[model samples]
Target chain A: MKLTKEDIQFIDTYLENSDVVFADIRMEIVDHVASDIEDRMSASNTTDFYNVFKDYMVQNKAQLLKDNRQFLKSADMKIWKAFLKGLVSPLTPLIFLTSFFGFYFLYLNFNIETFRLIISYVPLIGLSGFLLTYVVYHKAKNLKRFSVVERLAMPFWVFYQIPNIIFNFSYQAKNLATVLWIVGIVSLVLTLMLVLVCVSIKLFKSYEKQYKTLA
Target chain B: MSNSKLYKGSLTTIILKLLNENDKMYGYEITQRVKELTKGELKITEGALYPALHKLEAEGLLDVEVAKVDNRLRKYYKLTETGTKETVNKLEELAEYIKTMQALVNPKLA
Candidate 1:
């Protein structure tokens, strides 16, 4: 049977305020209403649409366009898509900044004598800690628990690399400081990745938790 | 008319007890029956009723049959084996409490 506008109102009123029930019922209405409009067309479907569709929605005359129900999903979709796009889109530029400053300072600060002293005082053992941060942070895809290990690994970086970067590249201890300067560059790259991975994990976990609670 | 509060949490028990007495009922028919039996004192809202039916169906307490009527599909609910057992237990518990309330209220009224 073809439903009139009143028929739609009857069913909608019957469903009351249940949103999901309205969704399920309204899908059936669209199918049947379209089918009824299709069956009566000979001259033009355009001519029939006004007559058939108008009668079907005469009672929809009172409802706001938002009350149309069909547009509900589209209306609620855009804000979230933009928010998530904003969250991860800046990581590349930020990581590049870490790499540039890290490499440049190490290049500017090391000289032969202080670099030699850095070798005597700190050994290459700190490189192992920095390298561990570099490899593990990338390998894990920045999972949350990795951040705790990243924090513990950071101290070894400070002990080995940060102190060894001398301020003046023009100085006489220049050759030794230059070698130690290379270590600083490596540490800067590792440090940025280490911290970025930890920040990413916390954010990823928060997003996951938010979705779980919403569910 | 759709906004009356019946028993706070006993609607399920009431529905089970009523269905246990009869055979099966569709949503519209069940709402009609409750209104008739309760003299319009209990009106189940459609929003509340459908979700309750879905919850009972999920719990394995309600068996549902979908049938077409006059171009519209209607879902009918019946009790599962477990639901029948639950209905009997719930009715017995409610009856005992009613009897206790009657004894208390009768003397106070006297």
Candidate 2:
């Protein structure tokens, strides 16, 4: 009654075709279905593997897929919330405050027009390019494992860019002369904080380790 | 027997209680264990079980470990420290609710 390699393979293909994308979720479903099939086979009434699987899927597929989607969405939200929690926690305030003050100090010290111009463009351009390149490169490297959150990271970065674009376009040179220091400081703090927060969040590390063996 | 809707609300407490007793369990094992414990009057559907487990894990109440067994990867879930503490609170809450329901349903016993 144990599932053979061919049986397991067939189940794997069936799930993939059914659009169960994440390997972790797929593994759980596969195990559940396989175990259910084995149990039915041992009952001695159901002999056909395909029929058992088909019946199980017919009964459970919608709920299974819906649950998978819900779990992924909730997981993504939880990770972002955790990242925000990390940012606002007492432990990390020093890091963000330090960055904030560091940028403010740089603005006060480096008041040159060219220096202001360069600082203004550097972070906006640099961060946008870095995020784009990271997304493209990571997608290219691990296309199969590019999860919903990973794909969503691109649009999320673009959302960040909307503010940058507005700030850059709306501020005149005279306005910049008046508050370039403020602009530079705010942009630097925001950009560095975003990068730091994104890289430092380890909520998914354990899942990533488990997934390494999967897809 | 309880309504499925009523059972759904207590599913987390039920799961926590099971994990507290057993130390670890996988998806199928959990459903089977629940059925065995309930004597088949209650069945934990595949739909309900996996999402519940994942949600608890996301909430940091549970931890997951994947081990290879019989040539396939099996994901096991167990309670975390927070989950252990939460289980006690949830069980107390459920117990009080059950007592209240009993008094309402069987006034002579009260």
lDDT of 2 by residue, A181-200 (tens): 45544554465446433543
Q: Provide TM-scores for the models.
A: 0.37, 0.80
Ten-residue segment with the worst summed lDDT in candidate 2 chain A?
A: A195-204
lDDT of each: 0.50, 0.69
Instruction: State the lDDT of candidate 1 residue by residue for A58-95, as single tens digits.
Output: 64333422233422332222222322343355664565
**Model 2, CA-based lDDT:** 0.69
Scanning candidate 1 chain B in windows of ten residues, the lowest lDDT window is: B66-75
Stretch of 10 with least lDDT, candidate 1 chain A: A74-83
Query: In model 2, how large is the Cα lDDT of residue A133?
Result: 49
> What DockQ does each listed candidate score?
0.01, 0.55
Provide the fnat value for model 1, as a fraction from 0 to 1. 0.00
Top model by lDDT, which number? 2
How high a TM-score does candidate 1 get?
Answer: 0.37
* Candidate 2: count of backbone clashes, pairs at least 3 residues apart or interchain: 0
Off by over 4 Å in 2: A45-47, A88-91, A109-155, A165-204, B1-3
Native contacts, share recovered per candidate: 0.00, 0.45
